[model samples]
Target: MDKEKVEQLKIQMQQWLNEAEEFINHIPPVQLYTAVGVVLFTLILLLIIRLFKRTTSNTIILTGLSGSGKTYLFYQLRDGSAHQGTVTSMEPNEDSFILHSEKDKKGKLKLVHIVDVPGHSRLRPKLDEFLPQAAGVVFVVDSVEFLPNFRPASEYLYEILTKASVVKKKVPVLLLCNKVDKVTAHTAEFIRKQLEKEIDKLRTSRTAVSDADISNEYTLGVPGEPFAFSQCHNSIIIAEASGLTGEISQLEKFIRENVKP
Candidate 1:
């Protein structure tokens, strides 16, 4: 009895298919072609969108002065341990992995592509190659030695904020004050204000130069007002961390915010 019922259902399905075919055949060729094209186009469009989403960059760039401890932070993020004796990196240290802190968390985590670009003036050009695809840029500063390196650090941050890719994409930046484990490390607020002041100075002098001589692709801050991180096109926030002590919660938070788990 079940076999007989199954045979009847099969026949009914065939009849419905035949009817659908007949109806389609009766339609004008132009209408039929148009309908088919629409479906194919929709399917192709959906496929392209899916591919684009999958390929969207999950890169987070770590950049600042040579002694700013970017390489140490990079290792800490990847290994969840401060790699002792880390020196100023001569080249970009890059890797792709699920963040070490997230390893014990339940469920799937996305791979983060971190590039610690060397901060030497000569190696600075390498920063541009990664900026275009950066999910977020972390400008690490040595808060312990903030006063001494303040000018150069601010200058580097200024260049980053004014980059064509950074401005156009409006990439979010985290001003990370590193080495806060030391008793004398400056506060994030202090570092932020000083950076703003120094960058304002840079803006004035650079704008005075002829456009031909200016290297920055975009101007930072409002013309009449003092330069602040808020004046830039991108969203900028300040956070503190200690790469040597492995206290990098803020840094990980910024990463997870930009590159979803």
Candidate 2:
């Protein structure tokens, strides 16, 4: 703190700087340039990696016709129990949270952005806002009552599979058959086959119409071939779940596979 001590420290700091400068001057120019380049490259690389990780998507979209148990599944993921009997959502129900099932896992966990888009036809367009950044999509179906909703579900699913974002980005889709807890619930295979059949019919009807009436920009499947989910550019998978009974391991698996946490 004294003036003499401060002067001594300043002199020592100057000497250190001079020594550093002299050492650098003595080094070969090529080696010095290489060292500088390496450091700058490393810094740039680290910055780029940080930006990519930050921008990586944690979003998972839940979409299906109304009463297919998407809301139930959404609550079950966030709260570990379905908040049953609530009114249907007019808009998307979204939140960033660690899955309740993963709550007991050790160490820090990444948050998942779950967006449960309303299944009503009028609200389906809202899905476009989230599809670009989505890590995955779950298309729910009311398994027990699937027959009544089959045509509409096929149309919705066709639109999703053909979306530019979904097809180009290769966004993975999980077709979920919900209400499997009921004794009369359809099997996953049956639902998949029936959906294929329905979509095949829709593909024919829609392709025959004008583009103005056709909401799908991209074609659904191979021309003159029977429609199947395997024809999709992106991965289209079938799964089953029971929101009420909490049999959702498959759904959780799909989320973890895409989100990495």
Candidate 3:
């Protein structure tokens, strides 16, 4: 009877041990799965937050020679009209303007901060301060003055591109050949070709500047390529700002397609 009791006690102890071992074995996998699930959930949440942040933020900077319709574009963007030209100095305006379109019914397009910097040579310093923050640049060239003003326009563009390259390399630039309506003789393609020729000349000038051993000349480091050939490879939007012939729509489309905040 004593031996039988001892055997029964041993059997009960063994069963308890087995049960404990089973419990212990079950815990790690559950804990591991829980940990992995938590980690995955956290990562997914972070990714979603990052995506939302990126999609929400959008800023476009408009820069060009004075009288090229920078302010007109700004006003048109606000009131959807460009009856008269508007000019503003390179001052910060904290006005939030709505960009409405039938396509974006949800009003996802929020405050478009339009920075209208002075295009005069005197304002270059101020432009340097503001342009780096631009997600994209719209260069409005006067089509009527393309021949005479081409050099200055090209030089200004080069300067902007050089500065932006150092800071915002991926920013897209839309070279708008404005005042196309004034010149009924020249087609949009013709004007674009003329601009391309001027751009090529500028490229040659830039290359010369780079290759020249100007030990005597005041050096300001090797300037970046004024324009990325790849970016220019895209379509050049020609709009007659004098009369609104869907120019605003074209501008909006360009911004939507190229510039992501």
Using all chains and alpha carbons, the TM-scores for the candidates as numbered come to 0.83, 0.81, 0.63
Instruction: Judge candidate 2 at residue 69 and give its lDDT.
Output: 89
lDDT agreement of model 3 with the native: 0.60
Give candidate 1's error at residue 58 in angstroms.
Answer: 0.4
Candidate 1: where are CA atoms >4 Å away?
Answer: 1-27, 30-36, 43-55
Candidate 2: stretches off by over 4 Å:
1-55, 211-216
- Residue-level lDDT of model 2, residues 90-207, one tens digit each, is 8899999999999999988889999999999999999999998998999999999999989889989988987888887789999999999999998999999999998999878876
Which candidate has the highest TM-score of all? 1
Per-residue accuracy of model 3 over 1-261 as CA lDDT, tens digit each: 699999999999999999999977778787968988999999999999997765443566667776666766765665666645454546532344665443346635446666666677777577666555555667777766666676787677656554524223455667776666674424546655565556656655655664344322222222464433334422334544442433566667666664432
Candidate 3 positional error at 158, Å: 2.8
Candidate 1 lDDT over 186-257, as tens digits, reads 999999999999999998888777887666579888889998888888899899999998999999999999
Number of the top candidate by lDDT? 1
Clashing pairs for model 3 are: none
lDDT assessment of candidate 1: 0.91
Native-to-model Cα distance after best TM-score fit, residue 190 in candidate 1, in Å: 0.7
